[model samples]
Target: MPKPGKHINHKGRNRRFTNPEELEEERRKEEEAKRWRQKRGEVSSEEEEEEDDEASGGSDSEDESSDDEEGKKAKGVSNLIEIENPNRVQKKNKKLTTLTVDVPPEKPQLSRREREEIEKQRAQAHYQKLHAEGKTDQARADLARLAIIKQQREEAQKRREADKKAKEDAVKAKTAQTQKALGKK
Candidate 1:
């Protein structure tokens, strides 16, 4: 029976392309194609080889000696030019670049007015606090005295009401006796 989707077996039992050499060659070709794509994108082993080649080729000893000789010749030409222009005066720049900040001296002593005002305010606040404490103590004492007076007045008023009630009861009993005598007549 033929399987679907390009004859690769679902059970993986049948190998149609039977040569092992052809299979290995096909795998090698696939890998080589992948590497070639990576190299074309500058991201593979061949690209790294080219970079190593360029770095090794650019720094030969003959190129280094020629660069050193050119540098020495340029320095010698500058020195010769400066020696020939002997009368050319190098002007000194008069512009100030660095800044010097002037700091004020510290004062250890307070002014007389400030010291006097501070002392005066301190004394005033102290006296005011003492006066307030004295007033508070006096107010508490007055409240205690007033409470005693109110209690005494309440006791006296109660006693007066009791005495008045007793006097009314005595008058009522006396009137009942007068009524009895008048009824007997």
Candidate 2:
């Protein structure tokens, strides 16, 4: 093969890359070095320190105001205790009389769709039970009535859809004619 084409070694060039796992390890070491550089008081900005101080100061002010209010309330309760009669302490220790307010039972509310579904389920179960009890004639009659009702509902729905579509078509035609007359189409 013509002296191995000048004996050039491609494997020696790839030795720098060696294994795929070594590449991953090198990447992890780079990330760890960057994190340590950041931790050595070299990465945090002054604006971030200012934001931290502002947040801490806001919470401290809120806590001081709450402590002052609590102290004032405690002083007021102490004054009240000093002004009260000592002989009536037993009466004060007794629980205060509470008035019980009677409330009326709330009426349960059901949506129209929920009520319809519940009624439909109850009717289906009743019909199935009747059929299972060998009431074949009654079951057949109920099924026929249900079929008639379903057909009537489907016919009404179709009529409504047709009417709506016709209305929409008429509006679209009118708009198109107007646009054509205006020379905008």
Candidate 3:
């Protein structure tokens, strides 16, 4: 009993086992295709074997030929295309492994405490540098001291000028008094 709407062949089981002659014809067609490929310079093992046999001037035995034919049939159309092992190919267009000095290596995974310590050290160094330049708030006392020293220097300069003017005035007065006394005498 055949399934509904299914095509049945009362002669054979399925399309694969249909006609032995049809299978043989299909095998012949495959051989013809192989011959055409050979003409186009695509060589297979079977073709190579036939060439070797011809070169050696010896005929292959029936069993060996049949085995070779069976092997070719087993390989089928899949073997027609040449496939290269991807690993075997050295790709010129592949992205190059560039070793650049500019790119820093990955930092080692540090603990939170260690990272914070490093950050603190860097900040301390930065602040210390700024403090040395009198740029940080911590250097305000030093700046104030500098300002005081400058003010003191300016006061000392003024005092020196005043003392110099007084000495000059006294000398002028004494000279004028002596001249007047000499004239009067």
Candidate 4:
């Protein structure tokens, strides 16, 4: 595949735009953009050119009628009025990108140390949340390991007690036999 030509530069070296489907795709995208602008009550470049023509004092009957209709349309809808429906799922409203200038930032209300402490707490919470996700499985494994170790220790303790008891009983028996042998009889 050859590279697409960048405007007038490298013309013969490129051949990607030669496909009919690519040209149609580009054309369709442009048409869709024009439709979107019109739906948003925006005047496209073509409309702008027509407006310029009317401003130049074109005596066309259709242009004059449209101008009169535009004035009537403006009077029908107030600029201060808006339809606010919080439940409606729609695209973002097209309005001026306004930002509040008088709103104070957190920097004025909070000290630097306080802000840092809050950030540290937030970071700790996030870390704890991530650790908790894997902690359940790790805790189960640790408990199983501790149970095995405890059982082993208990078994060893029992074995030591049994050996001690056997030694004590054997010594008692040997002493009894020795005492009997030392008797006057």
The model with the greatest lDDT is: 3
Residue 61's lDDT in candidate 2: 52
lDDT values, one for every candidate: 0.70, 0.72, 0.79, 0.73
Query: Tens digit of lDDT per residue, candidate 3, span 32-88?
Result: 987788787566775767755766555654456567666553345666787778789
- Candidate 3: TM-score? 0.37
Indicate the worst ten consecutive residues by lDDT in candidate 2: 41-50
Q: Per-residue lDDT for 1-185 in model 1, tens only? A: 67566677468676576699998999899768766865565344444444445666745645654554455324236656655477888897665655345757777798999999989999988877865675666656877898999999999999999999999999998888898889953
Best by TM-score: 3
Task: Report residue 57 deviation for candidate 1 (angstroms).
Answer: 88
Better of 1 and 2 by lDDT: 2
For each candidate, C-alpha RMSD in Å?
21.9, 35.8, 18.8, 19.9
**lDDT string, candidate 2, 96-143, tens digits:** 455344767787899999999999999999888989775879878877
Q: After superposition, how far is residue 127 of candidate 3 from its true place, in Å?
A: 0.8
Task: Estimate the TM-score of every prediction.
Answer: 0.28, 0.29, 0.37, 0.31
List the candidate 2 regions with Cα displacement exceeding 4 Å.
1-128, 132-135
Which candidate would rank higher by TM-score, 2 or 3? 3
Better of 2 and 3 by lDDT: 3
Worst 10 residues of 4 by lDDT: 68-77
Where model 1 places Cα greater than 4 Å from the true spot, the runs are 1-135
Residue pairs in clash, model 1: none
**Model 4: per-residue Cα lDDT over 107-153, one tens digit each:** 55788899999999999887677656646566568778989999999
